[model samples]
Target: MKILVTGGAGFIASHIVDAYIQAGHEVTVLDNLVTGKKENINPKAVFYHLDIQDAQVVDIFAKHRFDLVNHHAAQMDVRRSVEDPVYDARNNVLGMLNILQACVKTGVQRFIFASSGGAVYGEQVTFPADERHQTQPYSPYGITKLVGEKYLFFYALTYQLGYTILRYANVYGPRQNPHGEAGVVAIFCRRLLDGQQPIIFGNGEQTRDFVYVKDVVTANVKALDRKDNEILNIGTSTETTINEVYEHLNALIGAGMAQKHGPAKEGEQFRSVIDYGYAKKVLDWQPQYDLQTGLKETVAYFQ
Candidate 1:
């Protein structure tokens, strides 16, 4: 199968690009190099250094006649979205529409979307929100993701396009950008490796469901063959706190840094976890890495 992986130069999509190549699929990568790094792109895949909203994207689609589009490119920062929603909408919403239009024009069969489990649920009423959970996205970033899912649904109904929406939890592993506001695991690991004290926000009790990147890649691989036009949560049902994450990374890196506290950013979700039971049932997928093991691997990568 010929696949176009948007944001294939980024942390998560780069891993997915490698996996797709390993599975003997022809791959093409489209990335603007905004947040995505060129070094992360797989050499085996054809590379396009352009944004998703570019008019030339249609040319790429028409020329290649791609079988599937694995959409991962977006304005992923929650705080950044809060600061400038129009910018977020332009990138996340309008950019995705551009890709979808190309997909439609070129007769692309399927779209595998990378949605957010944490932000889409907002302040969850349930301990571990499932696919059925009500969506009350707190930030413009989350709203855009939810809107993306809805757009996919519309496309599926109108154009007969198949889609699988994978609502991912906090994905962390090797290739994760430590400088980004989104990836706490990468940030803490980098800070600890540099012998700097990692800051804990809001008493360190805010929890997130951190899934490994490799596990997420597996789900993408499975989505290729799946015919279901459905939405699924891709996360471990367990919630781990920020302090616990820091402790794990600190021990793994042998940094022995003391906990430093900072004021919690407003509108940050205090507790976020998603149930992947439906994913297990449908995709035959379950998270292979526990937090401890995943953190150790992450630490090793940083070292």
Candidate 2:
């Protein structure tokens, strides 16, 4: 199958691009380099340096005539989204429309979306929120993510465009950037490597579900063959506290730096975890790497 992976230069999507190319699929990578690095892109795939919001994307889509689009490009920062909602909307909403419209015009067979499970289901009432949980997002970033899912639903109904929405947990692995729209895992690893203390927001009891990037890539590979228009949560259903994450990384890196406390930023969720049982049933996927193994690999990358 011909696949076009947006944000393919970024951490998670780059790995997906590699896997697709390894599977002997004709792959195209599209990234603006805002948060993506050129070095991360696989040379085997065609690379296009363009934002997803650009009108030029239509031409590229038409030229490639891609069979599927794995949409990962977005304004992913929650704090920035809260500060400038219009900017976030332009990228996450309008940019998405541009891609969706192109898919319809070019007759793309399927679309795989990378949605945020923690962002959409903010401050979960249950321990691990599933696909059926309420979507009461706290930040504009989360709101826009929810909006993207709704747009996919609309496209599926009106245009008969097949879509698979994979609501992701906190994905971390090698090639993850340490700055700009980065997760706590990357930031912590960077700080430890640099011999600096990593700040713990609030009391450091806040939890997140950190899924390995390779595991998430497997789910994407599985989604290609699934024809059902479905939304699946891609997570380990295991919640780990911020403090525990720091401790694990510090142990792995042998960084003797102490943890420093700071005031929590706005638009931060207190607790988030998602159940991927539905994903296992539908896509035959489950996370293979646990936290310790993932952190060890991440530390090696930084070293």
Candidate 3:
């Protein structure tokens, strides 16, 4: 199968691309290099250094006739979304619309969308949020992701395009940028390795379900062969607090550094954990890495 992965040079998408290539599928990558790094783009993939918002995307789809498209490109920063929502909408919302349009034009069958579990649920009313949980996105980033899901549903219903939207928890591991938002583990590990003080916002009790990149890649691979069009939550279904994550990494790296406390960023969720009952039942996908194991691997990546 020939596949097109938007943002294929990104940390998560790069891993997904490698998985597809390993499965003996022809792969193409379309990335603007905005947040995605050039080195992360697999050399074997047909690489296109262009934005997804461009009309050229449609042309590429027309030419390749991809069997599937894994859309991961987006404005990912929640803070940035709060500051300038239109900018976020342009890239995330409009970019998705462009991809959907291309899918329609090219008669693409499957679209695997990388939706956000961390942001989309906002403040959780239940402990482990599931697919049926109430969605009240607190920021424009989350809103755009939800809107993208809606677009996928529309395309599936009206255009007969099959889609699997995986709502991922806080994804971390090798190739993950320590500089971006949702990069707490990477940032803390980097700082600990460098013997620098790492800052912790809002008492470090803010929690997240930190799933690894490899586990997410596995989910993508399983989704590829799946026959059903569905929404799945990819996560560990366990919440780890910021402080707990810091202490665990510090212990793993043999560091005694104390995290500095600061004000929490606006629109940040206090805690989030996704229930993967549907994913397990439908896709037979389960998270393989716990926080400690994933952290050790991530530390080794930096070393």
Candidate 4:
């Protein structure tokens, strides 16, 4: 399969690019390098240094004649989205539209979208949200992600374009950027490695479902096998508190740093978890890496 993976130079998509190449798929990567690192790009895949909003994207699509698009690029920072919504919408909404235009114009068959199970659901009323959970996003980042999903629905309905929307939990693992992707595991590991104190915001009781990147890759590979045209939550149906996460990382790093507390960011979700039963049924996807196992690897990477 000839596939175009947007944000293929970023943490998660870069790994996806590697797996796709290893599976012998003709893979092309498109990344602007704003948050994505060039080093993260798979050497075996073709690379393009372009943002998703660029007009030349259509030209690339036309040239590659891609069979599918795995859309992962976005303005993904929640706090930043809160600070500047127009910037967020420009990339997440407008940029997404540009990619969709390219796909529809070139007659690409399937689109595998990377949505947020946590963000889109906002403060989840359900302890562990399922695909059927309500979507009342608390932030601009979440809103834009939801907007993209809605557009995907529209595109699917209007153009008969197939799509798989994978709403991911809080993913953490190797190649994750502490600044942008903002995996708490990565942040803790980096801070500990740098001999700095890792601060836990608020009382540190906030809980999130932390899924591993390798598990996410499996879901993406599975998504390529069919066009189910459904939104599936890719998560563990489990929740871990931020304090617990910090303690685990401290143990993994063997750092004796004291727990540092800070004021919580405004508009932060208190608790978030999502169920993957739907993904299990449709994509046969379930998380394989537990927190401890994933944290060990992440700490090693940072070390």
Off by over 4 Å in 1: none
C-alpha-based local distance difference test score of model 3: 0.91
Span of 10 residues, lowest total lDDT, candidate 4: 178-187
Query: What TM-score fits each model?
Result: 0.99, 0.98, 0.98, 0.98
lDDT of 2 by residue, 225-281 (tens): 975789999999999999999999988988877788899876578999999999999
lDDT of each: 0.94, 0.92, 0.91, 0.92
Give the winner by TM-score: 1 or 4: 1
Better of 1 and 3 by lDDT: 1
Candidate 1 overall lDDT versus native: 0.94
Regarding lDDT, does 1 or 4 come out ahead?
1
Best candidate (score: lDDT): 1
| lDDT at position 283, candidate 1 | 92
Kindly report the root-mean-square deviation of model 4 from the true structure over all alpha carbons: 0.9
Which is superior by lDDT, 3 or 4?
4
- Residue-pair clashes per prediction, in order, are 0, 0, 0, 0
Tens digits of per-residue lDDT for model 3 on 1-303?
999999999989999999899899999999999999999988889999999999889999999999999999998888989999999999999988998999999899899999999888899999899998999999999999999999988888999999899999999999988877658888888889988888999888988999999999999999997546799999999999999999998899888887789988866889899998889999999998888899999999987
